[model samples]
Target: MSQITISNAKKIYHDTPVIENLNVTIPDGTLFTLLGPSGCGKTTLLRMIAGFNSIEGGDFFFGENRINQMEPSKRNIGMVFQNYAIFPHLTVKENVAFGLKQRKLSKQELEERVDKYLKLMQIDQFRDRKPENLSGGQQQRVALARALAISPDVLLMDEPLSNLDAKLRIDMRQAIKEIQKEVGITTVYVTHDQEEAMAISDQIAVMYLGEIQQIGKPKELYHRPSNEFVATFIGRTNMIPAQLLHKDGQAYIRLSDGHMIAYPALNHLEDQDVRISVRPEEFVRSVDGPIQATIKDSTYLGLNTEYIVETGFAGRIQVTEESTLDEDFGPGDIIRLEINAQKMNVFSADGKVNLLEVI
Candidate 1:
């Protein structure tokens, strides 16, 4: 099993601790992503796992084999970088065969392996062309093909799709997801793009300020984030300050308009001030709804029409609804809204902990 288990990993630069006490496990053959903003030590952690950076403390293991002191080349891991590091002097086929050649595989076996990934990445027709002759997406495919041709135990991708255009990035990400599933190689993908990570990963570890805030499947992270950062970073949310009141042995949040919404999730804390994390989609537009709002701005984007609305007490918040020809709301238009209490998240006033159970 090529599962990756990191235990109490620590990385320090000079006298500053960049990452400390980080523990995470990547199951075999699953596409796990380390996602966060820039300067958050995600790349640092990825390099540590790749053996390019020294682990100041803790164990880095692939199954049972410890790799902290191992050389990078001997780690049996394939790395694809953001720049698509295919040798420009070599043809596509030659680039795909580079690692196999380094291992001194027989010519027939090398050629067969190269051909397999070349076709798997669907760059076979461009096998004879140099890197410059390929489009950005095609070059990325060449890089992926080259990485997989060696049949490594694990694959590491660091923003491999960041250089491509938005449209091409979407296309290439879908391709990468399908290919990874087909090959079944344990992959650790690093990217700052939350949408890209959500689109492609089987599980994602959301990193923040050198620490992992949450790790779970895409939907789990989105619908039930562990903290305010994950709730705000993974997607857009309106943070409304409210009071958490315990009445009759149940938890509840009171809105500015005196509307109380029940929170069924157990938080084990006493009644106190809390914040509500309501996604734009969680706000329902109802003619007889309790919440009243005035439209500040609106943008129509095909399927969904988004609005910036101001309520009596919640200031300004985003609201989204399906676009319709007859129900278009513009500036100064009054509307009634209701919160989807079942989906909205209640967090502590300090934004450190969610009031609901988080796994």
Candidate 2:
């Protein structure tokens, strides 16, 4: 496995900057996902790493070697696209063996590698079938097997599971993670799906407008987001505006609806405007809670109950309840809401993480 480094990279197209001074270091043998919405330059950054786009500044290196000017084929990178990109006329065995054949390996070596990867991908039984004969999931596996068969130093996947059905996508994520762990290949995955990135990534970089907003482990980013954008983008969050209320050295913010919430004083913003980010799961149903709300609506999901509560202080808050037990809420039901301020993330008015002040 090889570590991929991109330092101060810039990409411009038609005089428009797509990515600006981007810096990311993907650890060796880890799944690093670049996650963002459409037109946010996640795919552009991936293409640059794969040598499909030119970088105007900074350096890109695979291990110790500078690959900023290297050809795509010379980068020793394996790429899997959203579409399977399999040769329709070729059999599965030939598709997987194409890279080896290009390098002119002997017949016995080719057969050994093809057989090994086909079995590894669990598609050995369909080795002789054409692309049309295989299901979408099977074709995706074939694409992955072909990419892995070449023993690439780094693997780049651009939403490889986007085309699969929901069930297949979930199943394939497990398979991909296992295969990546077993092969120990450094991988850079680009996708906009938050759950997908959270599920499979060892680390995630949330980007927006060609700039990286935050980069960290899944739990770190989810639990303690660096900014409002990261908090709102990575998952569902209820952003409530609050005023910095001074207290015993620590900062306390009163919600707009008149509920006061205390925060750690480590981020010492005094008498400044701030906001509190609370996840849906952080709220509870309680009679003596600090906040009051009426259940505007509740959706019954199989595993959880999602409540849209109209809070007097914050407009609306989404609360998720585990469906393992019976729910006591429905539409238009008045309820008292509880907030766990300890688990809240505080952000400044300008959207940056409020780490300098205690809340």
Candidate 3:
């Protein structure tokens, strides 16, 4: 296993910049994910790390060795593509032994290693089945087994779960996590699904427009986003415009409904307009509070009921409450919303800086 590091990584295509001045560190034996929307440069970055794409300027290293000039075959990396590229003509055992053939291992050793990975991936029962006869999930398992049979120092996956069904995707992601843990391989995964990345990654780098917006743990990015983009992208949040007020030594936010909510006093935002981000589950239903709204819509989702409440001060905000609540809210029902100041994230009006840090 090795820690992959990229310093000042740059990629340009047809005179247009894709990735510029990129730098990140992937620790040894951890699963890191590059997450973003389509065309966000995530796949490009993954290809760069795999030595499939040209790195115009920067350094790529695996542990202590610089691999910028290294050939893809010499990188000793295993890749799992989105399509699970297993040969249709080859059986599961043969597919898994493909990489071992290149190494010229003894016949007994090759069979042993192939058998080991097939069992590890739990596809030993289907070892004789061809890719055409197996299910999507089974084919994916074959691909995974084949990749691991090589004992790669780094495993790179490019949306490996995209082709599977929703339920299978969940199951495969769990399996992938367990297998990565068992093998202790440094893995870099790329995906556009936020929940998938959160469920499987040790660390996630949120990319946008060829640049990293933020890099942190899933919960850290979800709970305390660095900027508005991170706040809205990582999860659902309501961004409300408010004015920062300072009375005596205390700082408060004044809503448009003539209600003031107390907040931590920060010297930088004494009397300036700001935006407040509150998660759907963070808003509490109350009889009396600084926020008042009318239910515009409600969705029953078994575990929790989602409410779209329209407030005079905050426009429309989503609130999620447990379905166990005795009182059920419906459309056009007048309701009061209350938010905990500590749980709320305040950002500058332009949505660039997080004011919560100053507080």
Q: Number of the top candidate by lDDT?
A: 1
Better of 1 and 2 by lDDT: 1
Clashing pairs in 1: none
> What's the ranking of the predictions by lDDT, best on top?
1, 3, 2
**Which candidate model has the greater lDDT, 1 or 3?**
1
> How many pairs in model 3 have backbone atoms within 3 A of each other, for residues 3 or more apart or on separate chains, i.e. clashes?
0
How many clashing residue pairs are found in candidate 2? 14
What lDDT does each candidate get? 0.92, 0.88, 0.91
Per-residue lDDT over 23-103 for candidate 3, one digit per residue giving the tens place of the 0 to 100 score: 999999999999999999999999999999999999999999999999999999999999999888999999999999999
For all the candidates, what are their Cα RMSDs to the real structure? 1.4, 1.6, 1.4
Tens digit of lDDT per residue, candidate 2, span 227-323? 8899999889988887777776776778876677766553355587877888999897787887778888888888898999887775678999788
Report the Cα lDDT for candidate 3: 0.91
Worst 10 residues of 1 by lDDT: 261-270
lDDT tens string, model 1, 1-359?
29999999999999899999999999999999999999998999999989999899999999899999999999999999999988999999999998899999998899889889988999999999999999999999999998888888889999999999999999999999999999999999999999999999999999998999999999999999999999999989999998888788887788876788877574356788888899999999998988889999999999999999999767789998899988878999999998898888888889998878744
Give the clashing pairs for model 3: none
Ranking by TM-score: 1, 3, 2
- Model 3 scores a TM of 0.97
TM-score of each: 0.97, 0.96, 0.97
